[model samples]
Structures are given as structure tokens and as C-alpha cells.
Target: MGFADTIPARLGNLSFRISLDMSNNSFHGYLPKEMSHLRQLKLDLSRNLLIGQILSALSNCSRLESLDLSYNQFSGYIPKQGIGNLTMLKKLYHIYLTWNNFSGAILASISNCSKLAAISLGHNKFSGQIPNSIISLCHNKFSGQISNSIGNLRCLAVIDLSANNLTSEFSSSELGLFTSPNRLHIFKNCGLKGNIPDSIGNLSNLVILGLGDNSWTGSIPTTIAEINLSSSFLRGPLAPEMGELKDLESLDLSNNQFSGKILSSIWRLESLDHLSLANNSLQESISDNL
Candidate 1:
């Protein structure tokens, strides 16, 4: 398309650029090689039709701190050669490559960016186990267990491995070490199986936890509340310990094999807005103590 032929030549003439945001446009075709001309601190080209490989020429932007190419049609193995150069700058921190057509194993070269804090590659076609260096990963075709190596990311704060094909146990001891105050962990619609680890309670700062539509078999952890586990194959008595979440807002445990009396504790969540316990084998009886 003419887009591939014309835009870069025009963009190159602009000077003194600190950031460039050209997102949410219809700009299609390959990223122009002349993109390297602008030494922007950040570049956002998300939610567009940009396609083909990411240009290695972008590595020339030595001062670049963030590069977001999400929600696009960009495909092929992530331009590791291009990205490898960018990481060497030690300044790039956030790299968002979500909702693209990119595939293949995540490159180990990403680890070279030791200063990296957030790397969101969700909703891609990438296969294979997640790299140990990753702190934030999600929504790909990744299989196998959630690696215990993720515990190594001391600065880790968020993980959203939802809607993938992962099947295995979570590393309780490793995941328990996360101490971020605003942590959000989601692992819904995957093939994960095993007990909801007690160690999950350690994440006191958790605001959102999604574990729905999996094969997990266990009683809901009392330490967990305001969460979603609908359609997951969980079975066991719903623990009365759920009343501890005075701040609980939403709870969904429908379409499971849970067999027990609905605890009065659940009826007491003052912050509860949405509650679902449908399609379960629970005994129907209500405490009049409301």
C-alpha cells in the first residue's frame, strides 16, 4: 500500500521529538524503516492495521523508554533482532505487543533488558513455555505449567495468563512471594488443575483474581473473595471463611459440582454487588438472619 511508501518520508522531517503517538489509525503495511529517524522517548502505534516485521531500525532511538504496538496485525516471530537492540539501551521498560498475529517462542534476548518492568504480550499466537525473565505475561497459546521461575521477578506485580491452553499447578511458594500492593493475577479459561493454594492468601493487596473456567478441584479458599470461578470444575464445601472479605464485591461459582449448604457468611458481604451460585449441587435453604 501507499502507506508503506509515503508516511516515513514525511515523518522524518519533523524534529525535536520526545514522543510520538500514532495509534488507533488505519495505517497499514510495514513499519517504515525511517522510523529510526525520530529519537522519541516513547512511541505508541497501537490499535492499528500495521503489519509485517517490526523494523530493527527502531533500535536507533536510544532514548526510547516505551514502545506499544498492541492490537495490530503485526505478525511473524517478534522482531528479536530489532528488539534485542532496543533492550541493550537499558532504558526501554514497557513493551506491549498484545493482540497481534506474532508467533514462535519468546526470545531469551528479552532478559537482557534487566531494567524492564512491564512486558505485556497477551493475545498473540506465541507458543511454548513463558520465559523465566518475564514479569508480566498473558493470553497467548502457551502450554505447560506456570513456571516456578516466575518467582524470580522480584519486582513483579501483575500476571494475566488468562484464555490460554496452560495446564498444570501454580507454584505456591513462588507466587506467594509477590509483595506488590496493587497486584492483579488472572488465570481464567485455561486448563489449570490443582488446589487453590493457601499461599495465595499472601497477596493481601490483590484487587482482582480470575480463575474461572478451568479444571481446578478444591474448596474455594476462604482467603479469596470477590473473585470468579464460574464453569471451573471445582468441588468441595464452600468454606464459611468467605465472610472474611468484608470488602468483597463480586463472586461467581456457577456451573460447578460444589455440594454443600450455602454459608450464611456469603449472605453478609455488604459490598457484594453480583453473586452467582447457579448450576451447582448445593442444598437450597436460606437463613432468615438477613
Candidate 2:
């Protein structure tokens, strides 16, 4: 059997608690209201069988800095009182709520956590545009245009919205907004169109970029390499700048409308171990250089 509803009442007396990790257990029933009395710093109740709405009274845990309630049977919208109202959460750094049945819009109030660095609400039924305060938003059923406000997250390092309904083209300035070192951006199958902005090269620490199965047009940006634009509508000649990615190991541009000759400079990518240009309009000529 899972933990009983009376469990919280037993643990409530320890008001000086800083961390409670009851993850991957059979703890069931609603989260207890008695949790509000403790000044916790971290709470992890993931991978459990717990259900019911997150109690608004939890806002009283003023020293909380990390919360992970992922992989559970929790239902209902996130507390309307807003987790942002917890002033102590201003120091919160991570929030994970993946693989749940939670619904409703991601509140703009989440930005109140000025020190927030990572947030994952993916694999949920969340709707509405991503808030500007978010550093990384991914894999939710979110809709609406990805606003340029995303650029405001100077501390952002990764963003993967791989299976959503976000649309719109990024202008040069918009693409250049991301300055995080070692960033990975994925937007596969998201109905995105328009050419990839050349400003993509501006991401000095980018390692992986996936934009496949979209309606993007235009030539592959010369400044970009080590990317996957396969199964899209990208056309035009391969750019010589393909040689720029010294660390590029894999490049996939197959099933597109690329024409003309392949860039010979691509062969010089020392780190490149896998390359694909299949099903394109390129004229074949035997090349003695392998």
C-alpha cells in the first residue's frame, strides 16, 4: 500500500525540515496540508501514485528552492494561488513537472523566480504561449507563436519544443538573442516555415540543432553545420560555409529539394563521421577524393 493520508500529520511537527525525498515509492493519497508548516529547501515526490491538486497551502514553505513532482498521477491545474506567490521561490532554481495529467496555461508569474535557471513541464496538456521568464520549454502541447520574448532569458542554455504547434519565422535579431554557451535547440515537426535565419551561427556553443519535418524553405544557412534539416522543403545550393563546423560530426539534409553540386569543403570536416544527402536533385559525378 502507498503512504497514508495521515502521513503528513505525523511529519508536520518537524518544522525545521529542509529536504524531503520520498520519490519512487508507493506514497498515495493527496499531498498533506501539514507540509505548509515546514521550511523546506527541496522536495521530491516523483514517480509515485499520488493524486489530487497541489495544495495552495504549500506556498508557506518559504525556504523551498527545488521541487520535483514528476511521473505521478497528480491531476487538476497547478494551484491558482500560483507558485510564484511564494516569495521564497525567488531563490528556486529548478522545477520539474513532466509526464503528468496537469492542464492549464503556464503562468507568467513563474518569472517571479528571478533566480530560476531550469524548468521542465513537458509531456503535459499545457496550453498558451510560453512565458518570457522561461529559460527552457519543451515537449508540451503548447500553441501560439513563439514570441521573441524568449530572447530575454539570458541565462537560458537549452530549448526543445519538439512536438508542439508553435509557428513563425525568426528574424536575424531574434535568432541572435540566444547567447548561452553549449545550447541545444530542437523544434521538430512544429509546422515551422521560412528559411533558417543566418544568425544561427551566432550561437558559438551550439552542438545539436534539429528542425526536421517542417515546411522551411531557402538554402541551408552557410554559417550552420552539424544540424538536421531533413524531411523538410529546404532547397537551393549547399553553401561553402558548411566547412565552418570544425566539431560537426553528423549532418543530415536528406529528403529535401537541394540542387547543384555538393560542397567539396564538406569532405574536409575532420570531425564529420556521418553525412547524408540522399533523395536530392544533385548531379552525380565520380569523385576520386573520398
Q: Each model's C-alpha lDDT?
A: 0.75, 0.75
Candidate 2 C-alpha lDDT tens digits along 25-135:
777788778877766668898888888888787777767788898988777787746464645456677788888888888877776666777777878887887776653
Q: List the lowest-lDDT window of 10 residues for candidate 1.
A: 1-10
Shift in Å, residue 277, candidate 1:
0.6
Inter-residue clash pairs, candidate 1: none
lDDT of 1 by residue, 122-156 (tens): 87888998776664456678887766756556566
Q: Give candidate 1's total backbone clashes.
A: 0
Q: How close to the true structure is residue 172 of candidate 2, measured as C-alpha lDDT? A: 72
Which residue segments of model 1 deviate by more than 4 Å?
A: 1-6, 13-15, 84-86, 133-138, 180-182, 223-225, 287-290
TM-score of 2: 0.88
TM-score of each: 0.88, 0.88
> What local lDDT score does residue 208 receive in model 1, on the 0 to 100 scale?
74
